[model samples]
Target: MKDIRIGIIGFGTVGSGLAKTLYEQKDRLRQKTGANLTLARVADISITSLPKEYSDVVLSNDANDIFNDPEIDIVVELIGGMEPARTFMLTAIAKGKHVVTANKALLSIHGKEIFDAAVKNNVEVGYEASVGGGIPIIKALKEGLVANRINYIKGIMNGTANYILSQMTDRGLPFAEVLKKAQELGFAEADPTYDVEGIDTAHKLAILMTIAYGLDVRLDDINVEGISSIEPIDIEYARKFGYRIKLLAISRNHGDNIEARVHPTMVPENHMLASINGAFNGILINGDTVGDVLLYGAGAGMMPTGSAVAADVVDISRNILAGAINRVPALSYLPEHIGKPRITPMTDLVCPFYFRVTALDKPGVLSIITGIFGKHGISIRSMIQPGQDAGEPVHIVFRTHRAAEAAVKNAIKEIDALEICSAPTVKIRILNPE
Candidate 1:
C-alpha cells in the first residue's frame, strides 16, 4: 500500500499540531487506519524555521505547490477566513484532491459552492473540525444519529466569552476587568470582537443548523446578542434566583419554522450546561428517539482540534481506498433531498426574560413599570428590588413569563421613554431547554 500524502495550509497552531501528530504517530495511525498518512508540504504567511522533522517535505508560502504536487493526495485547510482559504480549497478540489478544513466562516458563507465543486470533481470534503473541536458532533449528526429527527440543538460554543462571564459571576470581577485578563491569557484574541460580540458563535451556529435542519440560513437572519452590556449586578441577581448566565447558541424546530438564536441566556444553575465553565464547549441535542444527548469537550486548542482534523484525513484516506462508495453524506443528507427549512424571525421567538431596570427611586415607580408591561401585553413572573445604589438611583430586577420578543421590545421602547425608567432595560432570555 502506498502512503497518503497530505499538504497543510496555514501551519500555525492547529496546522503545526496536525503535522507533529502525523509525524510522531505515523506507525500507530497506520496500524489504526491501515493507511500511511504523510505530511508532504506546509504553507503559511511567514516562515521562521521548519520543525526539523518536516525537512524533506516542500516548505513554501505558495499554496499552488500543493495543487501542483502529484504526490499530495489531500489538502487540509486550517486557515480561518473566507478569501484565499475558500479560493484555495476550490482550486484543490478542481485539481481532483480531497479537502479537509477547519474554516467554519468559509463554509458558513461559501459552503454550497464548495460542496458543489467537490461533487463535480468527484472528491470528498470533510469539515468535522469546523463545528466542534474534538467532539465528533458533526459525525454524530451525519452518521450515527442520522435516523432520528433532530428537534433542537443548544450549544455553549464560544469559550473565551464563557470564561469571562464565569469569572465575573463566580469571582465577582467586573466584565471589563475579566475581559482584560482573558486577552492577556491568549484565551481571547487581541481584537476579541467576534468572540465576545456573538459573531463567532453565530458563524458556528450557521454551520450547525444547516446540518441539523438542512436549512440554508443567512448569517444575518440568526438573532445575535453579545455579552458586552452584561453587568455583574445582573449576574448576581440571576444567581440569587438559581440561574447561571451563559452565552448560548440555540436552534429549534418550531413546527414548520426553525428558530436560531445566539445570545446571553439564563440557564438553570442545576443544569449541566451551567456547570460548563472556562474555555470549554458543550452541546445539548434533542431528537425524537435519542431524547437529550450532551456532548462536551475542549472547544478550541491545538491538539484537540488537530485530533479532529487527523480523524478526517484518515477517513478520507479510507474513502479513497474504498472507491468513495460508503462515506457519509457531506451535509448529512443527499443535496437534493435536503429540504429547505424556514428560519423563524427573531421577533417570532417566544421565551422568558431576565431584565434589569434602573429607575428613579420613588413611590409608585413599580406601578409605572408594571403599567408598561401591562400595556404591551406582558406579564411579570417575579421581581427583585435590591435597593438604591448610594445616591445614584434604584435597581430593580424583573423576571417575566414567556412572551413574544416583539412585545418585549415594544414594551422596552415605551419604558425607555418614561421618566421613571432611566435607560433601556438590560435583557437576557431564560432557557429551561426542556
Candidate 2:
C-alpha cells in the first residue's frame, strides 16, 4: 500500500513516452488512485540516448540493475523483440516483480512460460499494450466484456498492412507501390515482411485467442495469408461486387472448436471494418449478449503504444495497493481453466470465396473450370467475364457460396494445371459472418 516504485526497460520511442506520461501526470494519477507511483529508474543499451529532460531519473545500461532492485514493485518492458525482452520479463517475474509489456511477438511466442513463472512467483503480468496499442482491446476482452460469451473477433490489427491495402484500394496502386510509399512515410519498417505477410497479425491473434477462449494458442495455429499477393485488378473486381479488401485477423468460437485465421478478406463496403482505412486499427468483436462492438484507433505509434504500457502500469499498481495478488489472471482465465482447444484446420473452414482465374479465353475453357468446381462441391454464386471471355488471355471473376477451404484449394489446383490456364488463380476469403 506504500509508494509503488516503477522501473522501465528499453528506452526507445515507447519507453520515453511512458516516462513522459509518468512525469507529466504523476500528481494527478497519485491523487486519483490514492497510490504513490514513482518513475524510479530506466534502462537501455545506451542511457545517453534518453533526452536531457529525463536526466534526473536513474539510467542504467544493464537491465539487471532494475531486475535486482528490491524496492521496484513493477517493471515496464517496451523492448519489441523475442530475445532480451523475453528474458528480462522472465527475470522480473522470477524476482517477484510485477511486469507490464508491449512486446506482442515475444508474448505470443513465449507467453505461457512467462505467465507460468509469474503464477509460481506470485506476481502479476500486465500486457494490455500487446495487441491494439492504445485501443484497450486487451482489457476489454479480459475484463470489460467478461460477462458476454464472445462469438467472434475480426480485426484490422496491423496499421502498416491496412495503410498499404487502403492505398492500393483508393489510388488503384499496386501492393509494391503502396508498400514503398508506406515505408517512405515511416508507417512501415524497411523490412516489412511481418507487416505485409500477416505474421504480426497472427501473433496478436494468438494472444487474443488465448485471452478469449482460455486456450494456450500459438502463432503457428493460425492460418496466415498476406496482402502482398493482392493485385490492383482484384481490388477493382472486389469494388465492382460491392466489396472492399482488407487484411483481416479473424477468430471464431464454435462451442467445442475454434477457427483462427489471418488473411486478405473481401469485406462488404457497408461493414464497419471495411470503412477502417489508412494507418488505423478496427477490431470488430461479436459477443452473444453485446451483439456487436467495434474498437477503433491508431494501432501503433510511439505515443499510442506508450499509452497502453502506462495503462498496464496503473492496473498493476492498483493491484499492488489492494494487496490482492493475481486479482485478474494474465490471460483472463484462471490458471487451472487455461487449456488448448481444438483449432479448426484451414481445410475444414467454410466461407464464401472470391476467385479471379486467368485462362486462354478459348471455347470450353469455362466448362473445364466449372467442372473442377463441381467436382469439389463448390457452387458459383456469381460470375463475370469482365470484357470478353473469348480473348487470347481471359480474366474471369467468380464468387462462390459458402464452401469448404479444402474444396476451393483443390479446385484451384486443377484449374491452374490446365494448359488453358494463363496464371495461378487469385483466391481470397470473403467475410460473410451473418
Candidate 3:
C-alpha cells in the first residue's frame, strides 16, 4: 500500500475535527482502503491551546508550511474564507497535489477560477462537505444521478437558520428571541448575517446547482431573502392554512431556463421538507429516472463535517493509488461541458403568494386593495380579516392565485401607497405540493 500524506490548515471547528478523525482512525482507514492515509501536519493561526489527543501530530501557526512542503499529496483547506484559502488552494494545486475543502462561499464565488486552475494543473478538488455537511448529496448527484436530467432541487442546507425558524414555529417565539437563544447555544455565530440573511444557504445552493447541472452558478445569480421579516402572525396564518414557513433553497429546471432563489417559503403541512426541524438538514432532489430522493442528517457539527472531509481524502487517495487523476471532474463535468446557466429572472416567475396587509377599517379599503390586485392581473383565492373596531387598523391576509412576480410587486406598491393603509404589506411565496 502506498502512503498518501495529508496536510490540513485551519484548526477551528472543522479543521480540528478532520485532524482527530484522520489521526484516530488511521488504522481503520488504511485497512479499508489499503492505503496508508497519514495526517502529516496541521496548521492554524488561532491556536491558543491544543487538544491532548492531537498533540501527536504536527502544529504550525502559519499556512505556508503546508504549501512549502513537497511530501503532502493532499492539501485540505478548511479555513473557510476567500483570500488566503483561495491562494493556498491554488498554490497546493500548482504543486500538483489534490485539494479538498468545505468552504462553500469561496467555492461558490471563485469556483470558475479555482476549477480552471485545477484543470490546468491536472488535479482534483473534493467539496462534498460544502453543501449538506455529511449528507453525501454531492456524490449522489454527481455519480448516481448523472444519467438523468435533474428536474428540481429543494434543501434546508443551513442549520442555524433552520434552528431559528424551528424555534419560532414550535414555540410561537419571535425571531429575535430565538436568535438570541441560538447564539447562546453555540448554534449561531456572534455575527449571523450570513446565516440569517440567506447568504449562507445561497452559497450552498449555488454549489449544488453547479454540480446537479453542468453549470457554473454563482451567489449573485440567486435571489436571496431572509427569515428576519417572518413574524408570529405569519407563522400562525400559515398554520391555519395547513402550511409552514421554511427558509428553502430551491433550484428548478424550466426547459431552456432555470429558477434559483432562496427565501422564506410557505410549504404545505404534508410536504416532507416541512417536517424537517431544528439544527437538521434535508434535501429533496428529483431526477427523471429516480423520481424523488430525500437525504436527511445533521447538517453541521464537528464529526459530521470532519467525516465528510475524511471521505474525500480516502477517495482522492484511492484515485492516486490507481493513477486515476481527475477521474471525476471537480464539478462532475469538464470545463468544455460546463458553462453559465440560463437563470430565470424572478420578476417573470408565476407562483402563489401570501400577503399580509394592514389598513384602516373602512368600507372601501378592501375594494381599493382588490382593485389594485385585479388591475395588475392578480386574483385573490382566499382572505382572512378578523373583526376590528371601527377606524382602527385591521390586518387583512390574502392568499393569491398563481400570479406573475411583476404583477405582485406592482400591486403591492400601489396598495401600500394608499392613504388608508397603516403599514407596508408583507409578501411571501407559497409552494404547493406537486
lDDT of each: 0.87, 0.90, 0.91
* Candidate 3 lDDT tens digits, 1-434: 68899998888889888888887898999898898888778888877556777665678887778888888899999988898899999999998888999999999999999999989998889999998898998899888888888999998999999999889999999999999999999999999999999999999999999988899999999999999989989999999888889999999987788999999999999999999999999999999999999999989999999999999999999888888988887788778999788999999889999999999998988988998999999999999998999899999999988999998998999999998998999999999456
**227-307: candidate 2 lDDT, tens digit per residue:** 889999999999999999999999999989999999999999899999999999999999999899999998998888888
Count steric clashes of candidate 1: 0
**TM-score: which candidate is best?**
3
Q: What is the C-alpha lDDT profile of model 1 across 1-434, one tens digit per residue?
A: 66899999998999988887898889998998787898889887688568887887788888998999998999999888888889999999999999999998888788888987888888889898887788888888888778888899999998898999999998989988999999999889989999999988898898888888777765776888899889898899999888999999999987699888999999998898999999999998888998988999989889989988998998999887777733677888777776665888888878898888888888888899898898888889999887674545688889988889999999888888887777678889999447
Q: State how far residue 365 of model 1 sits from its true place (Å).
A: 0.9
Rank by lDDT (best first): 3, 2, 1
Model 2: how far is 107 from its true place, Å?
Answer: 1.2
lDDT of 1 at 176: 87
Better of 2 and 3 by TM-score: 3
TM-score for each of the candidates: 0.97, 0.97, 0.98
Off by over 4 Å in 2: 47-49, 388-391
